[model samples]
Target chain A: MSYGFVAPYTALVIAFGVLPALYAVFLAFTDNEGGFAGIANFTKVVSDFRFLPAVAHVALYLVIWLVALVVLVSFLAVVVHAVRVRWLSRTLRFVFYLPGALAGASSVLLWLFVLDPTASPVSGLLHLLGFSSFVQVIVPANLPPVFAIIAFWTGAGGWIVIMYGALNNISPDVIEAARIDGATAVQIARRIQLPMLRKWISYMGIMSLAAGTQLFVEPQLLSQASNAIVPNDYSLNQLAYQYAFQQNDFNGAAAISLLLLVIALALSAVFVTRGGLFEKD
Target chain B: MTTVDVGRPARRRNPARRRNSVSGWSMRTIIAVVVAIFVLFFVIPIVWLLLATTKSAHALIVDNPFQPGSFGDLAANWDQLFGFQDGAVTSWVGNSALYALGALVITLVASIPAGYAMALTEFRFRRLLLVLTLIVMLIPNTALVLPIFLELNVVGLIGSPLSVILPMAFFPFGVYLTYIYFNTSVPRDLLAAARLDGCTEFQVFTRVALPLAAPIVALVAFFSFVQNWNNFFLPFVMLPSSEGYPIQVGLTSLLASTPAFNPSSAGAQSVQLPTLALATVISVLPVLIVFLFAQRFLVAGMTAGGTKE
Candidate 1:
């Protein structure tokens, strides 16, 4: 009966999720003409000129994204918790979350207008910074950080909420006891809360790393919007997308995807071992 | 879970304790400034989006970009957006609704029961199932698109709605959340009592557990809906025609035709910035509205996996 209850979801997972992943692994070893090439496709994909640069671009973007997200979300969560003002905290959470409501493509498009100096609401700030054009604003040196900002805008709020929930789960008795022992709010956050949040933060870090490596929509759409001046092969996922869709190299795409899957699997291993995500409660 | 007692003694001492522990004025000022900056960071782009929708393309480029334009201009922008490609925006919106809702139903039906079974039953390969779900949940959706596309193509389902809907239904995060919910919140004693009363396992779940799982159900439904609705890569790869696009993909096509994004497009002359902004606004409105209404459940859903018993 219990097996019967689990049957439908298991079937769906096997059919759609597991089977496709296995198929992807199989496809990665085969050539375009369906010949089993025995790692030739992997070798070719790794040596593709755009592959290394795309990897480097995503690596830089991930650093900026991880740092900004952790700092901002932790800071906001601590401050919002300390303030203890109900309405203010709720409103801030909602406002931060508003961008998440416009998550995938919409957030990317919104940032395009925001980054365009002539069409942006922050045009005054852009002028002050000596950015008179979209090209000036989105220069090569600024692309990673700019992408980080966009990703942060759309991604940070949900993490903030999760961090806040973690903070809330901390027994107030511990906080009160610390307060009685003359610990300031900052000290309490640094000494107690931050240490307590180690697991959640690790979880955040691992998940963000996995997601950041697959950065696609923002860079892809930005490249499209900027008339390809932004470089269409701006990230690993985009490179895979380009190979599969544009060049009709499905094998190369599968190989690149397999690389990303390995990375994801490595990160998940780290998360499970270090973050204790699946420990028996 | 010790509820922080903030009633009499703690409330009476909090102000004094706060002042003594931290310089109240300076700390308050610092918090205010930091929060204000973050608020502006989050709010400015959205506010700009709203204001940008009201202006003409020329005004969007030439006028004070932050300032509001007339409702008359807004109406004109609406007309241009609806009039583009002979009302294709409407079809895109309808397609999005159909796909999102269809996937939402399937996700709820499949994920909820699966989660319930994992939590409540001693099943074969239970640990394997749980671990697999976590791993699949962690893998980026984009990574699977190529293989799913190939599979769909092999089956001649490319350009069909099932290509999108069927894949969207396999939401592992939903299953994980529901698993956590049932594991932590649904008591074992209740199920045992139902079993003692001669209820079968399915009957215990349906009659006893389902009613108590409303919050988790809502949480799963809201997330699955948003994910399916905002999903771009899968549909973009699977659905080949503009006629089948969800609003997110359709907006990209509109962007391709807009002069602001693509100067070389022949349709660029007809599509304007305001119209594009309006299309963006229209595309996101449903998710925003859902978020506004179902935020309580969303917050609960997002945090469910984080909290340990």
Candidate 2:
């Protein structure tokens, strides 16, 4: 009876999620003609000039994104929690969360304007930093962190809301006891709240690791807007996309996607083994 | 630490607690400043979009970018935006609503029952299903886009609404959110009582569980809508015609035409900056309106898995 209830989404998941994933893996091993080419596709993709640079670009982006998300989100959550002014906290949360509503393409488009030195409201600050044009602001070397800032602008709030909820989950009795014992707010945050947030921080880390490796939209939009001043295949997913759609190299695209899937699986494995995401009561 | 303990006997702790309550002036100032910076970080770009929509193309290039332009220019911008390609922007908005709402209904129907089964039932492969859901939830949606594209192509469904709507309906995160909500909030005793009273499993789920699942249903609906509405990659890849394009995908074509983002485009002269900004505003208006109305549910859905009951 319960199986009946589970069947619909299970069918959907298999058709949409699992079967495609397996098909992607299967396609990765084949040549364009449907014959098995073994590791040739993988080796060819790795040797492509864009491959290592794309990997490096995403590696750097993942680092910045994960670090900024964790540090900034946790810090803001604590600070917002400490402020304790009812309206201010709610308003701040609402403002922070506003960008989340603008996630995906719209936020990326908005940041195009924000980063365009000529049209940006922050043009004064951009000029102070020695960037006088859109191209200068999004140089190849600056793209990762620039994308990180944009990612943070739209992405951080959702995580902040998550971490803030985690912060509020701390039992009031524990906090009351700490307060009665004369622990300062910082001490409470540092010694108590931060430790309590370990599970959530790990979850964020693993999830961000997975998501950051698939970085596509920001660099894609930047490259598109800047007319490829930023490299078109600046990240792994964009490379995979270009391989599939642009070059009609489905095998190569599948290979690159399989590599990403392996990384995702590896990260999930590590998270399950070490991060306690699915710990049973 | 020793100082506080030793001084406790000589002085009352109430002053210290009171001090804690009011924090120091310096800390308050710092908190206020940091919050303001964060607020600006989020607000400035959106505010810039709003202000830019009110300006003419000439004013956008020459005048203070931050300064608000007159409302008359907003109407002019609206005219240009709507006038482009005989009101393609309205068609895009309509397509977005149709696709998003259609996918949202499917998401609710599929996710809620699946979550109910996972949370309330002891079944074969339940643990496996949960783990699979978690892993799929974590896999970036973009990673699946190409493979799903290939799948849809094989089925000859590419460029059809089902290509976008069907794929979007399989929202793993929504399923997971519903799972967490049902697992935490719904009591087993109630289900057991229904079962003991000879209610069939389907009847129990339909009558008892469904009524109690409103908040989560709303939560899942809000998330599914936002996700489907904001989704760019899938629809961008799937839909073949401009008419089938959702607003998010449509915005890119609009961006390509705008001179500010693409200077050498053929439509650059005709697609003014304010008109493009107004298009951006219109594309986001549905989401902004949904958010304004359903923010509580969005928040609850977003943070549902974070807190352990």
Candidate 3:
């Protein structure tokens, strides 16, 4: 009876995560060329011209992204914490979060305008900086930061709200003592407040790290705008998609997808352990 | 006290002085500027999208692109969007409803049980299951698209709604949510008592835990629905027919003909931009309405079952 109670979910997890994972690993080995060709496909994936570039794409994006997120979101959380402007802050957070409310495909379409050169609101700023062509505004080398701008635009505001919620959890008494000790608001915040929010920071970092590596939509949209100069397959997953759909090599697609899975798994492991996801928070 | 600790005290003092010098105004102003910069970065594109729908395709390309053109052709645009390629876009909306709703049901049924099982029972391989679920949660949405598409193709469900729906139902986040609910909220002692009173295990779950789990169930349903509703990649690949495209995919296919994000996509019949924005607006309304009503539950759901019940 207990077994029956648990069976369906167990089956579902195995069906979705576990079995798919095993098959993905299997896919990393076999190839259309020789059928179960062993390390040949894995080697090709490693040596593919786009392989390191794709990793570089996400890495540069992640650095800018992680720094921007930590600084901006923390600032948003702290200010909202200080002002006690309850309704206004909540409404502002929601407005900021609205971009995320637009699904990725929609948001990408919207972002093209921000990145567009002529007659766009951003045109003046880009002109001031001497980037006249929209293509110049986002050369192949600059695509990472451009997408980071777009991804952060759509996603980061909600994170501010999440961090603020964690900030609320800090005990008022500890805050009061820091205040009574003649600590400046900055001192109180750095010493007493931000320290307490470390768990949320760690959680946010890991989640961002995991999500950052698999960057897609912005690149996909970029490819659409850039006349194939930006290979839609600039990200690993995009590479997988092109391989499967355009190239029709399910096995190669699976191999790349599996590599992505391993990266995600390893990151999750680090997070679940270091982030203390289920521990006392 | 005058003979303060040598190294540590000096380090603390330096940081404190710097921090104190950083007044709230500068911080607020700078942060606000940073946020405004991001806001403009995000807002411009959406505003451009809004303006795009107001023009004819010719005007959209030839005229001042950013300026909103006359609404003289709004009706004509709408007619083309709805009637273009023989009402193909409207069919996409119907298909989306069918797939999202189907996925929502499966997500609820599958996730609740999975969450419950992980939370309540001390089963073997449970720790591994927990770890694996976290991993699945992190896999980018589009990463598995190809593999799943291929699998469905081999099994011959590629063009059917089942390709999307079956995959969507297997919601890892929902499972984690349910597990958290069980772990934190459901009192173990109550379950033991129910068992002692001759209540079957199934009875204990349904009678006690299920009622309180409503918020999470609703959360899972909302998430699954919105994901399927907004999804582009899965339907783009798996469904061969336009009849199976979701609203997002349909909107995108419509937008492809227009430059970048222009609403006036070129077809046998010309369409305009505002209709596309209107279509975008229409596609988003259902999710927004659901979200506005359901957001109160989100905070509770995210925090719930994961920590103190």
**Top model number, lDDT:** 1
Q: Quote the positional error of residue A104 for candidate 1 in Å.
A: 1.1
Off by over 4 Å in 1: A279-281, B1-28, B196-200, B266-269, B307-309
Clashes of each: 0, 0, 4
**TM-score of model number 1:** 0.93
lDDT of 2 by residue, B51-136 (tens): 99999888987898888899999999988888777888889999999999999998888999999899988998998888888778
Q: For candidate 1, what is the lDDT? A: 0.85
Q: Interface RMSD of every candidate? A: 1.9, 2.1, 3.6
Fnat score for model 1: 0.65
> Candidate 1 on B173-265: residue-level lDDT in tens?
898888998998899999999999999888998999999989888888888899899998888889999999999998888888877667888
CAPRI-wise, candidate 2 is medium
Candidate 3 per-residue lDDT, tens place, A56-129, comes to: 88889899888888877787678767766678676666666666667766766665655666545556677788
lDDT of 2 by residue, A82-135 (tens): 766799888888888788778777888888888888878899999999999988
Which pairs of residues collide in candidate 1? none
TM-score of 2: 0.92
DockQ leaderboard ranking: 1, 2, 3
